[model samples]
Target: MNIVVPVWGDAYLDTFLEYSLPAQLAAGNVPALEGSGHCYTIYTTAEGRRRCEEHVAVRQLTRFVAVTFKSLEVVATYNAGNKYRTKSDCYAIELEAASRSGAAVAMLNADILLADGFIREALRLLRLGKRVIEVTGGRGLQDPIKTALDSEFREYNRIISISPSELSRLWLANLHPQLAMHYVDGPEGGSFHPSHLYWLAGEEGVIIRAFHLYPIVVKPNASPVKFSGTIDDDLVALLAAAPDERLIAQNSSDLFCCELSPPEHFVGDVAWRGNRKSIIDFYLGYRTENIENLEKEIIISSKPPVGELWDRTRRDSSDFIDTLISDLKSELLRRCAAREADDLMAKAAAEIEDDGDFIKAIGQMLENGHPIPLALEERSLRIHLKTYPDRADLLQRLCAVLGAQGKVVPLELEERALKAIVELHPDRRDLLERLRLVQVGLGKTAPPAALVSPSGEEASQTEVDFQQDAEEFGRAVNYRDMEPEFAPILELARRFTMTSVERMYALYKAVQYIEATQVPGAIVECGVWRGGSIMVALAALRALGNTERDIYLFDTFEGLPRPDDDKDIDVLGNRAINGWLPHARGNERSNWAYASIDDVRSNIGLIDYPSDRIHLIQGMVENTLPAGAPETIALCRLDTDWYASTQHEMVHLYPRLSVGGVLIIDDYGHFQGARQAVDEYLAKTGTPLLLNRIDYSGRIGVKVQKSSVGWLQKLGWR
Candidate 1:
């Protein structure tokens, strides 16, 4: 019987070959195509070779053709359409008999060895409304993942392989290098494949044992070829460089002895030397190494020995001794109980309705300060909504999540957005402070503009005065960074920008900030809740023809990754009300809602700026730095009210101020986290400006500056 075997990038072909009976037609005789269907066109050497030829005058020549493409084959061998095992439509196949009712199709895993990037790619394909086969690995058969899996012959867009052991070490090395290497043994079922995966990380030895008792001929190279594993940084580099050594072993330790080799003959000459075996060759079944008086031939590769630690490289500077001492010191004098803290966080993140309300759930938990994991990230998203209180502020959600989580969070959209905003405006404290508010506050929509003009052209003098006064009120309430006395803005009032709907969201934020601190620029509230008043200031700037000066937005777009030390933070994803959850880096950008700087910039357009003056830096404030950081900032928006973030912004942005620049904080009125960080920072640096509280509605704004003259100037500006 004539048949066809479709394969992926040549890695799994032999596996299928071991189980199938080859036709009399030789292996090299089958035609192969790189990227098309009908991969192999087989012909009889001297007679008719029919796929299912029933010619009365001719005899059929049975042959097998191997194709590297994906196609559905209809054969009578087995019924796969109704009983397919997976959800991958883009897979390979070997049509043993497709001319009749049921057929045997090889559903190849396309996303072998790739990670982070594919999940989104698959989703993107699905979002275009395509039905993609979701591949996941877990013990549960009734889980949502299994329902998502399909079994078509899917295309292999990305072919990557990795060692499961290596993946564990890679993850650990990021957290602790020595610790990762120490425990990188065994098949850790802990690492399961996500939905985008076409293939899972497998033990090569196990596959080799089933494929062949003897070694196949594969040449050695300078760069080690990848077999299969997590498609992380190391795995990608390895696969791009060298071929894997395909060998089998009895135990895990013997994996080191595995070796891959190519045919031992020169290109054209078939000097059929001794048996094809050095030790365990499959070609001639354990042939001797010596040929009759033949010259020594060596298989030279492009690179050297492989699997040497690249990502797991541990330098003396980042060794265990240093980390151990640091961790030990930190473990002392801890205030909160560990289990209690974890329980509190988990409780904050659990049990939210998926009405996509976005705010109700996230706002509640952030107010409670919850953490999240993969199993309950959706719940985290429901909580993040409370942070913004504005549907249009969707892009800012990632910064809050990443800041609350860590550099690498679970969500991809959150990761990219956080990185972009932080990169564009690291010095802007409002980014962190607003993110904190998103972390802590219940999500709410922005109130109608308290300062608005129907024409929407410019703010009235009365409205401007109202905004200026609101700034003053916030300053009056702030006492932490204040001295004996300080003058305030005369018209302590609240005002909004001359815009509508989305743009008006900024006004609610300004009102909130205005209520937070009353002092114009002298008494500062570092982190503003919701940023209503700050948005007002930016609108005020646009109204006053300062469109050339950019309003920078800084944030950890993923709402802060898990905190490294003793720091107060809101629940994860709470800051991003009415938006998607946070995303980790190394994933595709499409998965993220505010994954790019454009997402953040797009949010600012609602403010009605000249469109050129709105700058965004997305990342952890510490991790995000502009190329040529300014020497002295004119207006330092300290939105990161927490001690660590506030401290970080001050250290970085303080040096960038011009004389008489304003450092307006969004959280000078509340949040002990901000208060502690600001106090210690000022104590160390000797800034004597006091924080006078401002209250315009529920927001807070503070006036901060270099001197009394700066304060006076700030007051005049307000």
Candidate 2:
């Protein structure tokens, strides 16, 4: 079916926007109205085509005249006619006009409902009666692949797959879980920073693409003896000459891992082969709305026959009367013209009883297709913006405009050019309440405001010094050690909140988001330098009244892994000359990861957390998470400072996360290098993105069951 949408001015689209939909966009920026295709030109010219093909900027507005249609067999197999039924469905209606319309056969494919059920039924249909494609059963009554994959996904080779930067984050969820964010580098190897999330998602574009619970096998499918140039280009030759056929995946063909570290090999029948467009949503539509068969296009207008005719008929001889009536006619024509006069009158009336903006809207109608300055002049707004008249005049008039549109001056940031009037005048006192807005985040804390002094002024929101407040909060938070006051928060939490989440263990530095009960073994964080967080976690676990489970602290006493063969730069191929971080400026890697695990263990020894309960797995989590596995992991927190360490922990123990288990990632947020590892893992794997944060870059969260949904549209699912 053919669809059309009109593009118009977005009142709240930011020149510099963030991940969470900004308040301006959601609050009042009206959605473009769609009815009949009325206001667009299709991309049809050859030169227009050339401009689209070569230039990104020029091609941006290239709208298509999309058309989707199918033969009898294809139509039955594909579409299932969902688009024709629902009005609010998101599949189409965004399509531009397309140049080509054609029909094709649709082969069936099955998706297993694991990634939101798009292709599942088609594959089932194809398998039932196909002789051309033999269906060797995937599983009889028993599904072996599912069973084998699940067992292998968790704790394979004991190495977790994560990037370097994620290992250096702040608050972790307290267990192994998937997190997605964008953190790759620009030209200078400078990292890109965005608010972090700790939720699960399968495929995200520029973030962690794909990751999940799976065993990691490091051994190559074949011996290292044969050195046949690039395996990708010479796959079949290498496969045929290989010493042992046992290594390849039987009945699987094609080389997905050819460009990888070790080329992937499989000896099998054709796994999957098809035209790329077969997977693309084909906007096939018949030239069904044949205009030749259409009824006459017509519009009915309600009208009162008046004006010159009425004046003449009534013989109104007063010149003043004539001028007054003429002015009335002009005012109605200007404002009530974009769509309807009555609707415009209603809108303006809602804002102001008098039809003043209506008069302006009439002029705006006259100025359509004109330059913006001319349009403003036509509407008479240029004069008002230019001449404030006086402070008294400005205030009264601004108030009148405010009353008319019901718009308020911004209150949060005093220097907002858009909200500057409030900063300069009476509305400043209401900053706290009038600023009833918060970007969506993992927790419920208000994020900081824009730094007025920022050079750009518009895009930057710097972290402010709420130091005294934070100190007070921390002091209050630290009071759990000696008092019964903090129990009230939990009491309040229990009374007011309805969630299964209860505190398992609490540490100041470790991933405390995990709810640990009497778990079988100890809770361990490998690189605990300053005992602050871990002590908090341990104390909280003690506070939660679960004293049975232990807390294990692990680290390389000397600090950091021996910068391996690939450790000189970044996992995504960036140079790391010094320890300088993009966001943290001059802090060294040592500053981030260096800490005496022994010293931390000693300091926490004085707390209510018992020393015998705390075990130190010194070295790397690559060695630790695996060694501690099959020990019934209640919670696993990894805070090593690089990609290698992050990967080590994730691959090793994330799947071992018990039912309703929690895994916390420390550096998934605005941390520069960290989120890259996160985004890459999210995008390329089957794992999901979790918990998102707004104000506090240091966030806390939990994990859910494995998802059938690939791209979850939630706070932190990316």
Candidate 3:
């Protein structure tokens, strides 16, 4: 008899020779055929051969059976990328070797261990004209059982010469009783036995059959074609062979084997028997005459046959088995629910018609205590509100959830929903009050006075005072101390900005100065990377009741331009360049400074800032500032870090700065080029300005003295 094994990587090769191969040989599972002139052929890589030679078990096996190592590369069509195809090609080589030697071939997985007398029985069956013998009743050793027993078996050093019967005894005694005992007094008793019955119905008719075929032995030249390495490869091989010559052995007697892992798509433990049945049904459906017609009609038996021995074992181990089944069921349900939720969300995202299903999926996830992402939940609720606009209960629930989590609700969606609910039930003071509070949260000065009265009457003094108090309380929350009011700002900073809190607060203070001093002009910002600083300013403007100003934002919006190497070199002697830092020439899109115009627009939209008030001028400061900038700027934030752009902005925009207007120099302390531009402009114009330090990199200076000299004359260009 010729035993063929394909050992691939170092891990599989080491485990097979060290543990499985030695265990099989010690148990007398391999036939002692040294004098019979038959040999075991191992097809493996060159590395496999180098490692195999170091194994003492390989020398021991040579004493019983001739062991030959052949290069797996002999399969000229071997696909290294597809492991199953590689294995199939190796098997083809094994078949060719067996046919040439005129010996029966035992095709074995590298990861399996055979029982004593198994090879002898297979060869005997082959001699009786059984062209193919497929072994059944093979037990899969779960990892925990395999680990514990392999350790103990190695500690005892039993691999050199343990009896074959002892191998079965060791496994049967230690395996979970639910998997170990099968039948009483039958051939497969005291072992794990999995039998799958596949039933399929199609246009051709219904066919019911059992499918279990692996660890096969074949007579020389019995298999006609090489295996395809697909899931149905074994079935294809069996179908190709003459039926009368095929034998599905009743395995536990001497034809048993143990697999290191369960078959693909099948989980360990009795609870997952449904998965095994489903896998078999699926594969068998492919073999039917019409797969599309058979897919919906196919069904497999979920319950496997349980013999009297299993019943008796269940009585003794009922608690353990029940707990295992319960735990597995819970885990399986969780995974199924998560997958269903993901599928529903994807479907809803792909098509708006599935929003109802999406909502139910979120509700189910919430009930199951799964963490639904805030964005997903918000989307689901938005869809639900859109579909059923009159659902006030859902609107209330949304508000309560957002309030408890302190999450920013999609302001536009929530506001529309609240207004609709308030309109529908004008007498519901509670609904009106909720709408008023939502409006206040949204930075509205007050809910329209008519909204406070159902009959279009103005709100009384008491109601007006109440609204003012609420607004004051909303603003007075100590956000810098990490109050709940800071949650949305923190979230915005995390998503949009790479600036320190001090710098962000400086932007806020700039907004405060414009609001306090009543400086009249649109807010201007240069170098709006992802618009983080500008977003902070906008949020502050809304919070401080100064949202009327039109904001001017300037950026190349394609990331920074190629910096002047002579003028923009950093303190570390690395030139400031147009890419991700450190090497500074590649991966421009991934750089922290890179933000497309659309990204800034999206960030601004998140806060529901009025879009008409935002003027995003997309170009270098040198070109865009002169043409597109606001005529009178209350807040002139210069963040263009290079000397040329900074100097140009200082020359063109500084002269227009309102008296008492805030001038924020974002990189004054960090970028030498920016500091040079600011200092040069201040010196040339003789402007007396107090530049206060905000952080390590930021400076804020109120424009106390407007420059008398024109920007062009100050640059000596006119």
Output the lDDT of residue 131, model 3. Answer: 70
For candidate 1, lDDT tens digit of each residue in 562-676? Answer: 3323444332212321222333222111123222333334434456655423334444454333221322333555665455666777666654544334445444444445556
User: What global local distance difference test value does model 3 have?
Assistant: 0.59
Q: Candidate 3 on 511-621: residue-level lDDT in tens?
A: 877788778677888888777778888888788765556778888665676677677765434457632242222222222255667678987877667664676776666
Quote the positional error of residue 485 for candidate 2 in Å: 4.5
Cα lDDT tens digits for candidate 2, 1-718: 1222111112111110110111111211111212333222211124423432453322322232222221222111111111111111111122111212311111111110011111122223223421111111110111332232234321332211121112111002111111111111212322211111111111111111111100000112222212111111122232232333212211111100000001121111110112111111010110111111111111111122235543442232234224433543454455246326434533443353234664465444333421111122223432453454333333433433332232443332112222344444554433323233221131334654442333444325654445534544543454455345335333323221111122211222223344433233345564565444455566666666655355566665433443333344543344443432311212122222334554555667645754534555555554334633333455565555466666666666555555345555554443334455555665666566454442222333344554523435343454
Judged by lDDT, which candidate is best?
3
Q: For model 1, where is the 10-residue window of minimal lDDT?
A: 291-300
Q: What is the RMSD, in Å, between candidate 2 and the native fold over all Cα? A: 33.0
Q: Which candidate, 1 or 2, has the higher TM-score? A: 2
* Backbone clashes in model 3: 0
**Whose TM-score is greatest here?**
3
